[model samples]
Target: MIEVLYFAWVRERIGVPRERIETEAATVMDLINELKLREERYAWAFDDLTSLRVAVDQELSGFDAALAGVREIAFFPPMTGG
Candidate 1:
């Protein structure tokens, strides 16, 4: 199981801050697709991949990144610098 965390509008849309998911996905993109299939909320939250940022095991990564041995995956809007 991988811990999936949602932030900001993503959390609001998904109606949860985090969850543990059991997936057969080989990569982050695959995982996102699986979630998108689960519900409309997940579909909306992940609709625009370019507007989102992802982290695996607390380190920034791309959608194509491998999920092997990963414990956590976080999704959030892009951060702005003041």
Candidate 2:
């Protein structure tokens, strides 16, 4: 199972802060696709990949990043501050 976390608007859009799910996805992109198929909320939340950032087990990673052995995955908008 993978613990999925949502931050900022992502949380608001998904209507949840986090969840643990069992998936057969091989990568972050695959996981996002799976979630998107689950419902319209998920589809909208992940509609624009370029506007979001992802982390695999607390470390930044790309959509194509492998999910093998990963325990956590987080999705959120890009941080902005000076």
Candidate 3:
């Protein structure tokens, strides 16, 4: 199981802050596809990948990042510096 965390508007849209998901996805993009299939909320939250940023095990990563042996994944909007 991988711990999936949603932040900011993503959390609001998904109606949850985090969840443990059992998945067979081989990559982060694949995992996102699984999420989008689960509900409309997920699809809405993930609709614009360009506006989102991802992390695997607290380290920044890309959508195509491999999910092999990953224990955590986080999704949030791109951060802007003040």
Candidate 4:
């Protein structure tokens, strides 16, 4: 099982802050595909990959990142600094 965390607008859209999922996905995108199949809320939350950022086990990562040993994944909008 992996802990998936949704932040900012993602949390609002998905209607949850976090969840534990049992998946056999190999990559983040694979996991996302599984989620999108589950419900419209998840589909909307992950609609645009370009508008979102991901982290694996608290470290920033790409969608192609392997989920082999990852225990947590976080989704949020891209951060901007002034």
Tell me each candidate's TM-score. 0.98, 0.99, 0.97, 0.98
Error (Å) of candidate 1 at residue 62 is 0.2
Model 4 bad stretches (over 4 Å) = none
RMSD of each: 0.5, 0.4, 0.6, 0.5
Compared with the true structure, all predictions reach lDDT values of 0.98, 0.98, 0.97, 0.98
lDDT of 2 by residue, 1-82 (tens): 9999999999999999999999999999999999999999999999999999999999999999999999999999999999
lDDT of 3 by residue, 15-53 (tens): 999999999999999999999999999999999999999
Please report the TM-score between candidate 1 and the true structure: 0.98
- Among all windows of 10 consecutive residues in model 3, the one with the lowest summed lDDT is 73-82
Candidate 2: residue 78 Cα off by (Å): 0.3
At residue 66, what lDDT does model 3 achieve? Answer: 97
**C-alpha lDDT of candidate 4 relative to the true structure:** 0.98
Off by over 4 Å in 1: none
Cα-based RMSD of candidate 2: 0.4
TM-score leader: 2
Return the lDDT, model 2, position 45.
98
Candidate 3 TM-score over all chains jointly: 0.97
